[model samples]
Target: MIFNRKFGAPGLQRKKLAIISTYNENCGNASYTHVLKVAFSEIFDVDVIPLDLFLLQKPQPFINIHADAHIKSICAKLKNYDYVNIQFEAGLYGATAGAILRRMKWLIDAAPNLILTMHRVDVAETTSLIEAIGKSVRALRAGPLFHHFRNKEFSVLYHNIVLHCKEQSARKNVWIKVHAKREHRVIRDVFRFKNVIHYPLAFLNKEEQKKVKALPKADLAARFGLPQGSKLFGVFGYISNYKGIETAIKTVAQLPTDWHLVIAGSQHPQSIKAYKDVDPYLESILNLIANEDAERERKLAKLARVNHYLEKTEVVDERLTKPITDRIKFIGSLDDDDFVHVLRDIDAVVLPYIEVGQSMSGVIVLAMEAGGRVLGANNLSFAETRKYFGDTFERFDIGNHIELAQRLQAEPLEVEAARTAIFETYNIRNSVALQAQVFEGTYKNV
Candidate 1:
């Protein structure tokens, strides 16, 4: 009757962990959450409560359960569970201080043993409230600052920081988990959250890693229709603008014609409707075309007029002025197997993201498991993760196309180093063990 004593929960089989999320959403958050639920279910009796944004009542049994009002009923259903884990992002609930507060308050009233996994923790422009107020006052000096003080950025940055602080303060007993060590540091040091734990996203096992590498080397020329003996660089994730895909394409244009870049995944189904401006994918494509066509700026003008939606994948967008139609492949969304295959085949993986705030990338973790050489943007999240990365890992300035081109042209780094790194740091067994330790520690200390 002793199940998972190593977790220190001697009778863990009797305990249940409820993972609340928008269960079937197309975003990475949903996909990652699903995987975590599967991982956790092996240790604890788990339930996935379909909790999308605010609603008055359950629209088809937990599918559209209200973020604010319907929490009491959701809690009643989850009352048997020992703990509740909420997959939290500000915008996911509702992108307002009042909205997030209302939702969180509902959860607090519903469940006492709560664990919060913050996908993106908001770090204010200025750390202290005094500094924020000072900045706001300074903006008043620079001519009528009505809409936004200095910049037209999120007007509620100060508001969000305050609300987040209040949320953490109220949820002192709640276990706060973040993906990277840096996030742990930021939350603990800057925000001063006492109840915080840092563990990486659980990823592939050694066996799964072997499967990808063991899968007979992909024939790029034949399978994906690239030129023979050509270098294939890849960016593997759903298409998003901040991913610096424009930077990726621009870098590809700089490389030799034989060198091809495959945008491994399609536009995220959610992203097509998410952004207020142009689609992030289209924005990236149009930016590339704008750079390429200095004279015949027809594509640029036409695309600029488009408020939303690009029905066609304009050839000029992905080609990069190099007659590299066959070279630059926008092979739409792929299944898990194909994604792994692409990771295995690619020479190097470029993460040229502009401003990445997340603790760790699901894509980067997968690439590490597949043992692909990674060239990442110089940022804290990756820098901290670098400790666990091998010699194959390299970081360049964010949005620097030239440096990325130079690195991509270099010989592919040996995957053995990364494979070794993967086994040590990003393996599934290790992640599970860590979670067990965390779960036990939470109860023991409290």
Candidate 2:
């Protein structure tokens, strides 16, 4: 009978919801789970089970991943819960689709009321005949009927996924939820999953919203060491390659000194692991990033050296070019309260991501909810955000430095108007309430 203050725990027992996630881990899905756990706590007696899906390891070097222990663990644990929700991302679970499927199949058998929320589904909007044929060939090779024949783990994954999806498609309680609309279309149209749930990703709790609105206008110059009265633009979350950080960096160099860029975060620990495990090709790309980051560091060091030399000589060396890289600053990662406070402080939040296999972005939702002007890449996720939230955001071509720069140079969004659209359209409570209600209906019918 422990009573929670923020969200009252009812005297009578509430329905149980077991959220299966790497709750202690740092990932976008984990963050989302934390938010949902808080938001939905009012309705259900919520509990979390740490499913260390991404921490999969092989029995031996270059041998197959020993996923059976995890499978058995999930099946046993989930049977006791009234309802189970899996914060699923295929890549986050296993190295390949087949590897992930093996884990999911266990859940499909164990919990009838299991709901899987997929974060990524790569179904290109259009395809060539050859591409279609190639996919079909792969599907046949990887399908559960033929998975045993495939030599490499990678080749069999997608095909087996299609087979597993088809098998689970007819299950009433086994709901496939996705965050974006286009992803919903792909599930329904491409995979022929008629029961796909187009659930909107929610962010910012009532307390966080109150905190954001009550945030005092702080001295940004002193706090983050930026110039006084500079119009601060920001990029949030972990620094990654496809995140288009280079474009943002280059774009910052072109902007006026008054238009400062504040990178209000660092690389997340889990993301560092994801970079290592997900793709071998990404290793070479990351080496290039390391080189680029080194170059930036050198510029900063050189700026210091040149400034020190000039202080004594009191004259510019004619051969040396003066550096104008002072405005770009990287404030290390902040906790949730500080993140909201910092997000509330910024003039705009820029998402300059290149086209990639993301179903949706949690940042866009959070930024919109925080009542700031959002500038996002013109892709499926951002486009959906614009379509739903109206002029709360603007779009630029993905990785297009000139276009991104042009958008930044444009007049800033009116604060009151942006706040209005965001609060009115997509607050945390409304989205969560809708989800809980719909989820209850599913429970009843199931």
Candidate 3:
């Protein structure tokens, strides 16, 4: 009786797809789910089953009780769907690994055909014994048993999740989807999960693409209230220490006076304090700028004293210092429309994220899609992304501001390799077609 938009009356009896994710929230996963829900709805009878983050992330003793009840309710709705996909990130399910795994198992059992899209895969590109030893030392100093066992515990949970998916594939139908090739290789080659597939994230839908207009650089600078001739470098997304924003600041400090940094995101809601005080990370950034200003003042005062002692017309070195804070700007968080426009208009998009085992970055994809020059940290995720997106962006070592500054100062990318790759290969239409194949069991990994 229901008419499908893509197909006519009767509509080939559109298959049902239930996406299990955190919807109605300002989370990145929620945004991704929303995009997919709209796109998939044209072909399938789609439903978004919201994940209760509050209950799942409850503190201590009450967590287990509430989490179980919450998951049970979700499992009850999933049985009828032709295909169910969970946006898996581990931490979103529960505070502890055991709690997360138990709930995941319940969902696996409930769905006839399940697909797990892993947003974060804890496996490293390569293991280092020295890194393990360093963590152990830090754990000892921190005096917490949780810190000591955290890495090992996550490793166990990751393997168990993959194995569970593999086991489920044997009986009926189960698939594991990852955002990057690195994660796919790890699951298929490292953990030996045969059902794993790679699907790069699709950022700009039709509406979003329409919003992205390539404004002149002068107009963009005036809009953001910056010097007309200043070179603007920007970092987007929620403010977090892992974003490696400090490295960007340091890089700008080493650049020419005309070069400036624009931080275009505000503090994450989770990072906000109860009393409305700035979070520790945000405070650290402010203090760093303040300290730079004070250091400049101190040098100026010292120079003044030296000038007083010297003869009136003595030749002085032309080098002078100014407050670094003046060159930096915080434009705060932007809505979806402005985000794409600003990303396109900026001189370069800098991604200085430190490795936290992230499999996907929506910002990076969006940046590339907007046709901007992207400079990313040489972390595993970005390195893998370059390989996946056809070597689209330039890379600098993580936390090495000197290297980053040098890269930015050099010629901007005249060619948009990543953008071309995204448009021609990893795009929204292709992504939907691939998922359709997946749902029909006709998908093949090439």
Better of 1 and 2 by lDDT: 2
Cα lDDT of model 3 by residue, 1-446, tens digit: 01112543463888899999999787778878888887777678999998888888765776679789989998998878898989897878887889989999888888888888888776632445566567668867542344436866787888888898888888878888888988888898989998877878887754455446444434666777877777899998888988999898887667888888899998886675568667889999898888767776777777878888884544533323656887899999887667777888888899999987778789888887777788888898887787668667778899999999999989976655446535666766567666777777887666
Off by over 4 Å in 2: 1-13, 57-67, 124-166, 169-172, 268-325, 418-425, 442-446
Q: Locate the minimum summed-lDDT window of 10 residues in model 2.
A: 315-324
| TM-score for candidate 1 | 0.75
| Strongest candidate by lDDT | 3
lDDT of 1 by residue, 338-435 (tens): 77667767877888877646567777777777767778888666776665654457778988889989877777566576457456656666665555
Predicted structure 2, TM vs. truth: 0.75
Candidate 3 TM-score over all chains jointly: 0.87
Candidates 1 and 3: which is better by lDDT? 3
Residues 41-86 of candidate 2 have per-residue lDDT tens digits of 8777788877655455332324334456766777798767777777
Which residue pairs in candidate 2 collide?
Answer: none
Q: Which candidate is the best by TM-score?
A: 3
Q: What is the lDDT for 276 in model 1? A: 63
Residue 264's C-alpha lDDT in candidate 3? 92
